[model samples]
Target: MKIVDLGDFTVDTQARRLYRQSEELAAEPKVIEVLCYFIQHADRFVSLQELHQQVWQGRVVTDTAVRRTISKLRTLLGDNDTEQPKYIRSQMKRGYQLVCPALPGEEPAVQSHAAVETNAAKKNKLIQSHWLKQLVAGSVVSALVLVVAFVLLASPVHLHTDYLQVELDIPGQKASLALSPDGHYQAFVGRVNSGDKWQLYLHNRQKGQLAKVSTPVPHVRFVDFVANGAAMAYVGFRQNVAELYIQPVADLAAKPQQYVLPGLSILAGPLALPNNQMLIAGGESYNGNIHYYQLDISTGQYSQFSF
Candidate 1:
């Protein structure tokens, strides 16, 4: 069987199996095929079209599908798109290439008759020694378990009842708090001074750096970070009317997109949805009473839900 040797893994061409230090890795067949193709063309960059033609055998597949396959292969190979890839590297606007060296397969050595007999004798001795080692290892493990149990029983466990307290030095009172999905940054509405209005501010949990996210606004009722942590949505009041705005977290100076719900005063919400949609709860005066409505961000349409 032809076996190509990668630094940390070996690929069996005939069996179509990948092994890491003699341990078999559970990878999909397509992933292995992709890996083999990369290894075959390890010398240069393999374009996306070449991968589709050779690895997929000219099957009708979307670019997204190919990218997903590459992502899965990267995960299996212990690589990532964020970090500097060790095995597979992506060529910008092109395709991917195997960065690591994969040596060609070598033929197995032939054994002489006397050498074969000697190997058989050594194998039997190894089997006997293996049993003895197992017994010793079991005894050692049992003793270790007993010692650990005794130590755990003898040691008095102290309950930790201390709560972590974080203090932020702010010039004014803080309002709503919105933590990022990754728990790295926190966005909150805070007033700079007693007479000033509430504005959006961001706090870095790791660095303890606080910065203003928005300019001085009248009031920020609600704030929420997007799922991707790239942007945030907030409901702010202007001239006694509530409006929804979305701002990028990285560049707070950029103009935010404003979504105005005519005749409806937003009481709460601006919740983010998948694909740039937002859910809002507000009320509009109709007839003689205020009727609650749910507004869709995409179409700017509202439907009456409650009174």
Candidate 2:
């Protein structure tokens, strides 16, 4: 479809553009998908899970991603999730609705340029006043931020600081933890507290499920999830040799694909990157050099850079 009318704005679907009269507005493809989907279900509620499954096409994305798309669409429509929402009606955990889905052949009545300018001038004055208030608020916020940072660093955790910490009862957990790209699962290294070597455990926060994900090689130290969130990469040391391992989060029963990382006595990271690549930070310290490497999971090859 070329043009979609939605009250005050016109959306050009094929062009991936949004316009308010003659002024064209930037809209990303994903944002447009969200907007058009709302129009298709105009005045009806669409759940977040529905948007994730239908709009996102069952792709692996976090709830945060869906909310961000809604925010972007609302911005384009001159609306907000709270305070000054004009076009989209959002109900907490219920869904979203298009408030004014304009019927075909209906357009906003043209206003005289003089009248428009008069309104703009009034808005400009109000905006100037709003900005002055914001300037004062910004300074207060900066001071509060500094105080919060000092308290977090110098003192222990407290509700008076406005941050909550929840400790999950997983298997014997240690320090290193990795949250999946989708923010649904967390992987931590722990043991059974029965004189067992440390390995990896995956926890699904949404489902409240936990599982052990250990490779054939023991003593896993560092772990990270792949970009797609269905798989993970980790580093383990066995017999004074450090090896890199990649395995699927859905299934750890099968042996993980492992690669021998030569020359590095100590390994720290397997940072996820795009196109099945990750960053490995470790080098032969005894050789008087520590380095970071780009490891290709598909080919099991590592490339180092200078400086």
Candidate 3:
């Protein structure tokens, strides 16, 4: 397939990086393979088997892997499911294709392609989905047990003893703060003027008062505190559009790394679980009923709350 330019983004086949304007968009290695395959085979709908073989090779892969990767790629490209996607488009039973325009950009070298068919891939996808549903159901049961244990065995008096209050102030803005799971840190959001000007700050409650946790940037909205207190989540914006970002506290001075939060904006109420994974409440707005999403720290994948 011929690579097309979309003005803002270019699929770099030779480099395996998706470029927006002049900057590279962060995408997983596997996601790049899947996207590059579609970009190379634009227009024609490529079946799941073909995509899996091309992207995953002879290795076994679950349908959740494909769906999750596509979902992540779409989010990375800021594509929405409601409209005809400007990046990837799904043809239901037929397969998936790249429909968005690719702009002028450098190409990556030697991207492996898959050669699987539609029907076989679809069946695998169904099986993967069925098993995933069962696993999620089991997780829900486990989660309920934990919640109940905390409620019954752990007395309210003991829970109240762990309570800590942290306050933060950002010069020239109204600040909002969220406490970490261990309650040792707080993530703050500051609004300078209105509409879009925002800043993210970290306050170390364990250090006595609220300490500045981050360097000042143009627009950063606090997303959550790392479950382990080693990092934080925030939303970074460019040209008015925003994307989710994760930054380790030790590397606060360096440019923050970006993570994909497909189709959603404004991740908040960051809670890091004991399992060392992160959780962020996501939606368009807080009052809009955000869905809680678990971040797989290892794969950077998102799993939605089942119950």
Candidate 4:
């Protein structure tokens, strides 16, 4: 079995496994394929189109799926940090490249499927063993907590009946809702159904009509109006990476320009500021811990708030 040494971890190409020291990290099949492709083309930028052709085997797949796979690989490889992705580096508006050097090692004598299966079984057993120990150790405390929770839930509770409710006919769950500075249009991200992807939509209060914004990607996380409601700025996700985009509101058919923000994974609450700048909240971490940032809409430059 051929092994590729990836600094902190090793990739067993024959077995299709990634290992950090003695621990085997579980990664999806597609993620593994993507990682291997990056390693094979480590010298240059691998464009999204190339990835779609090679990784997905020329099959039609949404850009979101590729991005999601990359995200999963980043998490598994401990390259989740936006400021410095140790393994894979994303080139804005281009493709991704493997920053880490992978060296080939001597092939193992045993390359049979049974051997690979045995190794995978051993790794799973190790994981289950560790989980069993933790479960046993926490059983007593968990039992006590469950008892308390049950008692609290069983107690008679008074419910408030006096409450005012007003419902508006809006499609999907509204997220990152923002009103235009001129109060003419309301922009928000919405997913029509459970299986549908979130998309950006504009609600015109004057006309009482909803219009869909032409997003390049399937997922639109945040949106806000710029240029005095003549233009719109939004954070869009493609292949699990967040990018800033600006488009003319008058002509939604016009293609939007994508902006590269190196370390931001999730962006939210985009507020337009003076002088073609924006105030936004986003983060590099997966836990949704975010910080305020000021972005120059024209230049795509950003600086994080300190305090």
Candidate 5:
């Protein structure tokens, strides 16, 4: 039941685990023991000789070994100021003591509650702003074509039809673009120069703000807004293999879940369908025959479909 809340990190004494912002930190046994020892004896100073007898239990430990454990524990706690001593203070040959100045559980609880309130407020604002927008797309690539691939994709509304073309300030060549179903965001594939690697760029169309979407979307070749603007699915390559990814519109920065294609080698035609499903053209690797499939967005499963 003992937990050490160090403000920057928390320790589960029973599990011997150290965590920072919910991420489990890799620590040696000695590092955990040293951290736990410092926390349990925060009220008084701990001498080096005491640590050798108590924590190490006379295990033939050297001075360097003990110092290394202390150093590693400090790193895990993000304690950079050794002189001022934010978490643990080491006096020259005078041993060490925990100096974080918080009761074991008080600080982390306060921080977690504040974080929940801030996140709830932000989420409410986001949902309200997004609900006010809307995007119209009857075909899979119709809306996407109007954004990034406009110069190449053929529009059905007559070849010579004139429309106002407004260029965006984004650098380099843009490959693919998808407007959220509610027109709140734009997800596109772009690059810095001709040879630069392509990456997914998520733009808040309403706010005019831009950010780079992380991995799985890197080298992204195609993107489509799905689930009525709540999420998006895209085709990206990993290990030279074509993989599908699904990411939520609310959490675009989150790592997208990847889906592998079992039989189909060549994938094409991600036409939007009803019930959050999509139709894709799959071709056999050996034979040139193409097959049609229905992809379930919720499960990332693909099944054959007949015309």
Candidate 6:
């Protein structure tokens, strides 16, 4: 399935569903299906014949039917093609087009069985699996990203220098470490060499000296502290490509909980905010550039970071 996020609304082109935050916008099933077709072929202007072939599978339908379905999709997304056309664009004689910009490795929010009463209060969970599949299906191509970007958010709160300190391990080959808001613990990467082979080491603050911890993946290009310092978000590199992995910091001797976020070719840090939640940057290297996203620990929900 393919997923696209346009700030407030998330469109899953594969499933033909529109979600506002975490709640699914109620609409006719046919309308949702039509919207999906436009999103799948976002850049191309989908003609009536193409739309019918993809969405309806050669089903008979009038021009009025297509227009009405497109209209409903716009309304559900709080958009009007005539005014604020964020999602879809219409033509006089041609079919519709997707105007919203899609990010590489970006996922759309999927509404679960649960519903939220207010759109403002609901937090959308960006589903990555569906979006990744769609991109690969569209084009069998990939690219290489040379630079790794790091961004930190500013807040009114200040950390006591004594409680937390950051440094690069010797050569600083991997990403830097970050402390939680409370400052009870810290997380950083340790380096180890096995004769021509180099790897990142996972280290945490224990009783006294730093101890070695086994991560979800051994060799990684990036690592970040998450879950208020209870977990570490690390990325593994193979063939110059990276994928994200989440592991716990509780017991270094014990195995950590691992979560595989597919389609993520590169991941950037445990960027902690005032609320204590962490942000990680990730993307599909071959498809496009990277984008910043926030991850919720309690729910494991991810959303794109707005300026």
Best by lDDT: 4
Model 4 ranges off by over 4 Å: 1-168, 287-289
Per-residue CA lDDT of model 5 for 1-307, tens digit only, reads: 3766777677787677777676455556888888788877888889888999999998898887687678657655656467887888888767898998645552223336567668658645643444333223344456666654564465645555466554358768986677776778888888989887778778887788888878643467777777777777777765445667778878866778765555355665455555787766665453567866666777654545532
Give the poorly placed runs of model 6, Cα more than 4 Å off: 1-17, 20-175, 192-206, 273-276
Better of 3 and 4 by TM-score: 4
Cα RMSD, model 3: 15.1
The residue pairs in collision within model 5 are 134-182
* C-alpha lDDT of residue 153 in model 1: 74
- What are the Cα lDDT values of the candidates? 0.69, 0.73, 0.64, 0.75, 0.69, 0.58
Q: Show model 5 residue runs off by greater than 4 Å.
A: 1-167
Question: How many clashing residue pairs appear in each of the predictions shown?
Answer: 0, 0, 18, 3, 1, 4
Instruction: Return model 1's CA RMSD, one decimal.
Output: 21.8
Candidate number with greatest TM-score: 2
> Candidates sorted by lDDT, descending order?
4, 2, 1, 5, 3, 6
Residues 192-224 of candidate 4 have per-residue lDDT tens digits of 797878888887877887888878877888888
Q: Candidate 1 lDDT, tens digit per residue, 99-130?
A: 88888654333355677668668645754674
Q: Name the better of 1 and 3 by lDDT.
A: 1
lDDT of 6 by residue, 102-212 (tens): 543245444443434234234222224424554774454332121111111243244234654554335533345545445555555545443322344544344434554
Give candidate 2's root-mean-square deviation (CA, Å). 20.8
* Candidate 6, residue 82: lDDT: 63
lDDT by residue (tens digit), candidate 3, 193-251? 67756767666666755434444345665556664666776665555445666777766
CA RMSD of each candidate after superposition: 21.8, 20.8, 15.1, 16.5, 16.4, 17.5
Q: How many backbone clashes does candidate 3 have?
A: 18
Candidate 3 off by > 4 Å = 1-171, 180-184, 191-196, 204-217, 237-240, 283-290
